[model samples]
Target: MRRLAIPLLLLLAACSPANSQPAPPVGTKADRLLVDKSERVLIAYAGNREIVRYSGIRFGDAPTGHKRFEGDERTPEGRYTINGRNPKSAYHLSLRISYPNAADRAYAKARGRSPGGDIFIHGQPNAWPGPPIARDWTDGCIALSNAGIKQLWDIVPDGIPITIRP
Candidate 1:
């Protein structure tokens, strides 16, 4: 009975909402990506109107701590732009999120550490092939399902501003 309970717990944890649901499709050109770190949600807005929202984001493994160096597993907090896209990515597909802006670079340089680059808003890994994982598993990068990413690919373009708030 205890062994069965253990497997059940594992399955329950694996299927939890930590990672679930596809992100909303990208809308008009004026749409903005707004991240509320407190809620761990990324919402798309068109001039104060909500269009879509993605939740269950996993931030730096150390969410309460400040990002120090590369691989610190901390999603940056600040204003940035969507600079590019990658059809071939280690993580299925990805939308480049510009991190280490001048400010971030300066801060990291002062501390003698790399601000860590290659931050992206991306989808799940191919290994998870069945479907999007039921919870967050990124190393500080925003993640969407394969289908959600495809939807975003159609709507979002390069040079769009992204505002990330703590």
Candidate 2:
């Protein structure tokens, strides 16, 4: 019995979750993304721990209210995912955002309106010979600087969950 108890204790100790190493900070990797429209901030996180934060995000041209229809120019407000990526995007490298989830569709259907699509978090267009716009200026996508988007493209990957808020 004593020998059995010693082996059991050893096995339990080895399987303890607390024995795991601490998770690396936000820069190393991320499993989640969050965008706050009002504050104009986007954040990446690993579980509940925030990995990084990016500010100065540009939103849809309307820039107020939840997106409801095609050409509404309002950034959506809800939970979504990074569905895909476009390295050859018109804008400098973009990550596709899965908007118009079931709820969005339902809302549009109920109201007999068309739910807009093709939302993304992308950088500025390449070779534009002008200064950055001072405020919200997208069709219905989130905009970041070319440098910022490139950094995010490396840090975030496909299928990560993202939440957008008003």
Candidate 3:
């Protein structure tokens, strides 16, 4: 045991912050994205382990309750998938959320309303070339800072599941 101790200590020293290896251009893959609207935070998980938590999330103007129809201005609640991504998005970058599943469509259709689509987890608008907006201003999408969204874009891939909660 003593013979192995010195080698283990040497390995640890090599991994210290000053001597640490640089992080990869990309990061750990996130299998799941969890958004807590009540807390205004987004949590990314890899495998039962919490990888990243982003705060100061912005929501729609209404910002409460599950979105049901067009122009509702409320973020959707429940299970969805990251179905696609956009680099030429109006926002810095965006990952499409698969809203309006069968149930959502049925619910809206029954009420004679159109279930709005094009929901996404996106960054600030490209035209806004200054400080971040400080209000809940999206039509019904989740908004984060450009840097945060860039990191998410790198780590969270399409086809993963995302759960939005109230």
Candidate 4:
């Protein structure tokens, strides 16, 4: 019994909420969308308050590298706007991220490359047909669960600003 006691106690500790960390502080608004690339979290805020937080988002299949080149398969960093929505997305649904803005174009042009665009925030496809697993999976867009994307579609409007950070 003594030999089993330590293992049992460790298991209990692992399951204890006391050891679980609290969620990061969030505001209560729906104005801004903030993505923390390192944490892979997307927070929706209205003014200074947070409306909701979406976790387990998939990023560019090619993270940790520079974008702005065509076919790089990378998500761009910095600020952008939600320019449009697609009800008939190749995925379930999609919110367009205005990529290749002026600065992005300039940067790409400086390198003699095209700043590839067509970025989006969207849900999994009917073909893929399910929630994202516990890791990143998208080509260069932010992906959410079908249900999560639906909720966001109802709340987020075109022209909202989004900040993607490292």
TM-scores of the candidates are 0.77, 0.80, 0.84, 0.79
Poorest 10 consecutive residues by lDDT, candidate 3: 15-24
Question: What TM-score would you give candidate 1 relative to the actual structure?
Answer: 0.77
lDDT of 2 by residue, 1-166 (tens): 9989999989866543221123344458679999998888888887788766777688999988889998999999889999999999999899999988999999999999989899999888776655445567899999887767877888898999999999
User: For model 1, how does the per-residue alpha-carbon lDDT over 80-113 read when each residue is reduced to its tens digit?
Assistant: 9999899998876888988879888898899998
lDDT of 4 by residue, 12-55 (tens): 65543221122334422267899887876788877787767876
| lDDT of every predicted structure (CA atoms) | 0.73, 0.82, 0.87, 0.76
Instruction: Say which candidate scores most in TM-score.
Output: 3
Mark the regions of model 1 whose C-alpha exceeds 4 Å error after superposition. 1-27
TM-score of model number 4: 0.79
What overall lDDT, based on C-alpha atoms, would model 3 receive against the true structure?
0.87
Model 2: how far residue 104 lies from native, Å: 0.8
Off by over 4 Å in 4: 1-29
Better of 1 and 2 by lDDT: 2
Return the lDDT, model 1, position 99. Answer: 89
Superior by TM-score: candidate 1 or candidate 3: 3
